[model samples]
Target: MDQHAQRHGARAARSHGTVEPEHGATTAARHPELAPGTSGMKGRARHIPATVSLPIITALAFGCFIIFRTHTAGIKGGPAMLYGLAGAVVSGALGLVVAHFQSTLITETRASAYGALFGCSLGWVYSLGGEAILKSCAFGFTMGAVMFVAALYVFRTHRTREPHGLHRPHKTHHRDDRSHRLPAATH
Candidate 1:
């Protein structure tokens, strides 16, 4: 009947803390700081730290060994082994470089491109027989970029949320679900 009540329907006149939430609705207080607002851009760019770099390099090197070593049939202590070892060493080294320059905020595509650059470098050096310069460079570009962005994306998405006063109380919760959840006997 009153102006305040009419304006807010049934609960407009209620105090800020009194407005209860409806069913299944959570208060803003319960949610983590989300985006689209100021400071919503939580993403940041950074190089892979020392702790991560070594492991990444090691993984790539091991992969190179797996790939090249198994293929060379009986080339014991021969050019094949030498080349495989060399390729692994170079790949590992390039991985380190990729880790060092790995930027986070940069689009993952660009980051992968960066990684591909490093990877292709090794590919070109060892691909002496028939691989063309353009082909190797393209390969390196793709590999470097993919590697850089993938690493960054994984790291960025894995941040453990810190629960620091994140949620806001849902106004409708008190009025809707709670009222219904009451046992019929209690009602």
Candidate 2:
């Protein structure tokens, strides 16, 4: 067949959802692990290292912010360093705990977990500014509630398609509408 005809045929096949497989490669040749009757591995493998690294990254960012803020508040260099390191460790541990179990949770629970995490972290950092404990806690609680509400809204909106009842009914064309007809053929 000519190249143009072959290209047209291939395009038509793709539009119909079936593609001719490559001639020289057998299934076994492409993936040896799935040979004949063998069952490969079951279930999805957890990516342990990747999962663990997220919390470490979060901790580093949190610690850097704390260190910078403390130094700006006139803390001595050694004390500022200590505070940053300690904050990093604590945040990292909390992040690790959250990461481990987040996937198994329902949507609402997961949102609440993230909201609490953010609120508590921010509140701790706020306390470093010499705010009273009660003030810090209150600030954290307010921020957390806001986060929870926002997260809930996002999750609910994105997960589902709009209901049929919510959609405007499509307009139908009427054969009797003379305006839509072509002008009578001119002589």
Candidate 3:
């Protein structure tokens, strides 16, 4: 087909349900049973890859931390694995929850909440490893605060890139009413 015709055909196909080959399969095809535009207010949340990745990353990081910390503290193998696994599961679960429901909360609040959750999970894990309560709390709070600041920046940038909400003003067509009016009354 000629370039113009091919371009037109692609556009026409996109306007309908069928996706162009270069564009890849539709999201519904990949996810199955998830129709587009059906996710409601949190529709965009599913698109954010961090929802899945952050949890996995956090879990792995926790496992690593446990390994290093235990080794340095002279703790043995099985107990180190136990601590690591516990921290991984807890942090991962919290990360998943934050990533999934993040879109529903106010941007700043979501960041702070997620940070706090992350910090608390870490703090709890640290305490389980025999750290002092005061030290754990202080470390957790510091980590949480750092996360909060970082997340706030990231989320703000993300929000700006993708516009949302029902606050946009509608455009109305102004038509001249004089043409439809009756003749002015003459006494």
Candidate number with greatest TM-score? 3
lDDT of each: 0.53, 0.75, 0.73
What is the lDDT, from 0 to 100, of the residue 62 in candidate 3? Answer: 78
lDDT of 2 by residue, 1-187 (tens): 4487577664324445444446333465566555676455411122336558888988999899999988887787999989999999998998888778865666688679878987998888888888899998999898888888897676566555322222234777898887877899988
Q: State how far residue 142 of model 2 sits from its true place (Å).
A: 1.8
lDDT of 3: 0.73
- Candidate 2 similarity to native, TM-score: 0.55
lDDT of 2 at 146: 88
Candidate number of the best lDDT: 2
Where's the lowest-lDDT run of ten residues in candidate 2?
160-169
lDDT of 3 at 56: 83
TM-score for model 3? 0.58
Clashing pairs in 3: none
lDDT of 3 at 45: 61
- Model 3: per-residue lDDT, tens digit, 1-187? 3487677664436365565645665676566437665655355666658669778887889778977787667788888888788778777787788777866777677889878986887677567667899999998898889989998787676655423432233755456656656798999
Full candidate order by TM-score, most accurate first: 3, 2, 1
Cα RMSDs, all models:
21.3, 14.8, 12.7
Ranking by lDDT: 2, 3, 1
